[model samples]
Each structure stands twice: as structure tokens, then as C-alpha cells.
Target: MGKLLTVFTPTYNRAYCLERCYQSLLRQSNRNFIWMIIDDGSTDDTKQLVEKWIEEDLIEIKYVWQKNQGMHGAHNTAYKLIKTELNVCIDSDDYMSDDAVEKITDFWMRNGSNNVSGLIGLDADLNDNIIGTKMPENLKKSTLFNLYNKYGVTGDKKLIYRTELTRSFPYPLFDNEKYVGLAYKYYLLDTKFEMLLMNEVICYVEYLPDGSSKNMYKQYVNNPKGFAFYRKELMKLPFVGKKFKFKQAIHYVSSSFIQKNRAFIVESPERYLTVLAIPFGLILYLYITSLVLHK
Candidate 1:
């Protein structure tokens, strides 16, 4: 019989952190799942580390290698190869709780419906502490934007989706803009059907200095061009047409721009002044973003 869930880990050169993730999977209460590792051209011993685990017969591990194409590329590869009804991703630096698979599987068995496109679970840290357990009481039918803006979907909450409904990440080279990349895609899916909120802690996110979120500020400072691309794409989404989208866009752009580039503005007056004439507010949010990047 085919496995019910496909757990994928999109890893770079995080051989040091992959062990915890593999160990977590080996400890899963429900073992009827496939572990797919999409290695993004790691120069480290990642391949050998995974091979060691595979030899132990710990779990059904399948490893694939590709050129250094970034997180989105690894994700796209995993989506194409995953052969299960449901899919979930835990970063290589992160691990899941022992009963996570069991909890997710049980939730699907009891409530999984053809109309339901996916499920969302609570996420925590390396210490097994829940980050956003205090989610809104009624999240089962909330739109993707509402979940993030209102309900506060921060940290690494594990979201399980139907393999068919999943879409590829739009931007592959987005540096500071990685957060909006996949998170927004999931929200777009909410436009068609609602995802179930399991309200249980399933995964733990490790705080690695090299992790995407850690270097977000530097990414913004170095490549304002990437932010411009992100802002343009954000406006193109259909959900962004809703009233909430505009408000969220304002908040998103202003916070990211000011927070990351304040130092640059002080150090390089001419560079910052070049884009200062651009209007502030929603009418010119995309324009200002482009100016910053181009300046």
C-alpha cells in the first residue's frame, strides 16, 4: 500500500542539523510515511549522513541531489517526486515531535475530506516549546491572510497539504523575500478551499544563524532588488485585491524597508536620497520598492 503522508526536508549544507530531523522521523509513532530529502547541492557530508541513516533501516529515506538552486528549487523538486496523498515539510535545521506523524494521521483519518485541501498544526522550537499555541479559536475556515495577520501564524507551524493542490514557489532567488514566497502561496490556496487547523504541536524549528530568517536584514540591505521583485509579485496576487490585502501590503512594505535599510540611509546619503522623492503609502508602495532597488 502507498504511504499516506510524504514528509519532505529541503536541505542545503546543514549536515550538522539533519541528524535531529532524521532521529525525529525514526521515532514517529506512525511509520507509514516516506521521508524525502531534496539536497540542494551540499558540499558537506550531508549525503553520507543520510546514507548512514538509511543503512540503519531507521525509515524509508529517499535522497535526491540537484544544483544549488535555493529553497524554492528543492521544494519544487520534492513536490514533483512526493508519492503520497498528503505532504509536509520540515526544514533540515528543524525536527518534529515524536507523535507528530500520529497526530497528523489521526486528524486526517477522522476529518480528512475531499473538499478539504490541507491541515495546519502548531510549531515550536528545539526545546519542544509551542510558539503560537494560542491561535484563534476559529481558524478552520479563516483565509490565509487572516491566519497570519490576525491569528498570528509566526514561527514554523507545520501546514500539511494535498499533493495535487500544492503549487511551486514563484521566486527561486529571493533572499530577504523568502518568507512571503511560500507563505503567500499557501494563502492563495485558501481562495479555493479551507484548510483544517489541528491545534497540536507537531514540529520544532531550530534557530540557526545561517537560516533564512536570521539573515533577512542583511539580505534586504544587500539586495533591495529582491524586495522589489517580491513587492511586485505581492500586488499581482488575487487575494491582495481584497481590502485586507492593501492594509497588509502597507504594513509589510513599510516595516521591511525602514527596518532593514536605516543604516544604509545614514551611511550613504546620496543613495538613500535618490529614492526619497518617491511617494510613501499604498499609492506608490510598488513604485517606491522599485526605486529603492534600482537606486
Candidate 2:
């Protein structure tokens, strides 16, 4: 039978740091997963590095090179190509724990089903510190959204998803834009299925200065359409509270100003909320713009 899980990494010009992730995969106690690398138009030696690794034949690897699209676009291609029943993204700058694959497969086999999306696990730093607080041990299943807003779970956690669900809400691509919030798809999946939670640390992460997480202001300035698209969808979610929707509206307004979309209020799902958010949004827009300019 084929591997039960696919660990995919979407990368662009990260050849220098990609080896850390690759080496970590090689150390996996369980080799029952496939490693798929989606090369998002990297101008570096990424292809050459991956080619060498393929020759080593340490574990199953699938590498696909495509023209530069942002991280979301690379995810689009990865989901399309993945044939495994389950998938998780291990960022180019991050590495998995040696037993992560073993833990994930065993957990899923014991508890996974179509009724639940997949599972959420912990992420640690290089020193083995958990990025966020642990999941509520007594909790059985919860959507990603609830885990944060409702339960007050903090920090970044690892997510494993059913490949089919990951493919369901594809991030929209816009001209000259490279980023769309990855959570756009996750929130949509929440609408359909709640995820199982496991407190085990599965991945180690390092936030590089140039990483998207570190340069969100630049992302906002450069990818307003993508941001706008994400905010609009978040505002439409039914499970979240009005306060959450209002927060989304504020972001939507800010993104609209960046995109210079005059019809933002007319197009918003919550027009009244957007109207109330205009001043805050404008302030946020100026703040983001100032950061980008000074950066």
C-alpha cells in the first residue's frame, strides 16, 4: 500500500535552509511517509540540492519545479499532486521531529475518520520549546478556529489535513501578488469538519527575518488583493462572533484601501460593520504603509 501521509514543503529560494528540513526527515524513525517538495520558482540551487537528495534515495521523495508563484500558489500545486490520504506542510525553514511521522500515522490510524478533518499537533523551537500552549487534554475534537478564539489556545501549531479537504478551498491567485493567507482554506475546512487535537510536538520552527511571518507589512503592501480576498471570506464565516467579524471587517477595509477598491463597502458581506470600521481600517492602512516604507 502507498504511504499514509505526505509531508509537503512549499519553498522559494530557500535552498540554504531547506537542508535542515531534509536532514530532519532523513532522521525520521518512521519512514512511512512521502516527502514532496514544491519548488516555487526558486532561482537558487534548490533543484540541484533536491536532485542530489533524490540520488541518495534515503526516503521516498517527489520534487516538482514550477514558475515563481507565492507560497499559496505552491500549496495549490502540492495539493493537486499529492495522492496520499493525509498531508501536512513542513515549511522550508522548519524541520520535523524524528518521530513525527510515526506519531502522526499511529494517531490517525487509531482515531482518524472522515467525520473529522485530520489532526492538530504541537510545534517546537530548535531548543525543543513548544511554540504555544498544549491542547486541552480532555478535548476530543475542535475546529482550528475554535481552538484559538473560543479556547484561547495561543501560538503556532502544526496541522495535518485530509488531502481532499486541503484541495477544497483553493487560494485565489491575483496578478502580481504572491501571498494569500493559508488559513483561508483552513477556516473553510472548519466549516465542514472539526480537527482532532494531539499535544505531541511534531515540528520545529524558526522564524527567519525574511519569512512571510516576519514581513507581514510587506506582504500587505504587495498582496492587497490576496489579503482582501482572505478577509472577505473570514467575514462570511457563520460560527465566529460579531466581534470576530468586525475584526475581519477592519482588516478588509485596510486591504481595500491598499487595493484602492472604491466599492469595498458595497462588496462587503457585512456592509454596516465595514462602514463602522472605515476609520480604524484607514488608520491600519497608514500604519502598514508606514512600516513598509520604513522597512
The TM-score between candidate 1 and the true structure equals: 0.78
Q: Give per-residue CA lDDT, model 1, range 1-295, as digits (tens).
A: 6689989999989998898998899899999899999998899999999898889987898999998776766787888888799999999888888999899888999989879778888888767678855467665655556677677765556789998877544445653433335664676677677778778888888779998777655444444545544544454566554454444344344544644544432333233322342234333445545665765
* Regions of candidate 2 where Cα sits further than 4 Å from its true position: none
| Backbone clash count for every predicted candidate, in the order shown | 0, 0
Compose the digit string of candidate 2's lDDT tens values, residues 1-295.
Answer: 6799999999999999999999999999999999999999999999999999999999999999999889999999999999999999999999999999999999999999999999999999999999878889899899999999989899999999999889898888899999999999999899998999999999999999889999888999999999999999999998988999999999999999999999999999999999999999999999989988986
**Residue 287 CA error for candidate 2 (Å)?**
1.2
| lDDT against the true structure, each candidate | 0.71, 0.95
Q: What lDDT is obtained when candidate 2 is compared to the true structure?
A: 0.95
Worst 10 residues of 1 by lDDT: 265-274
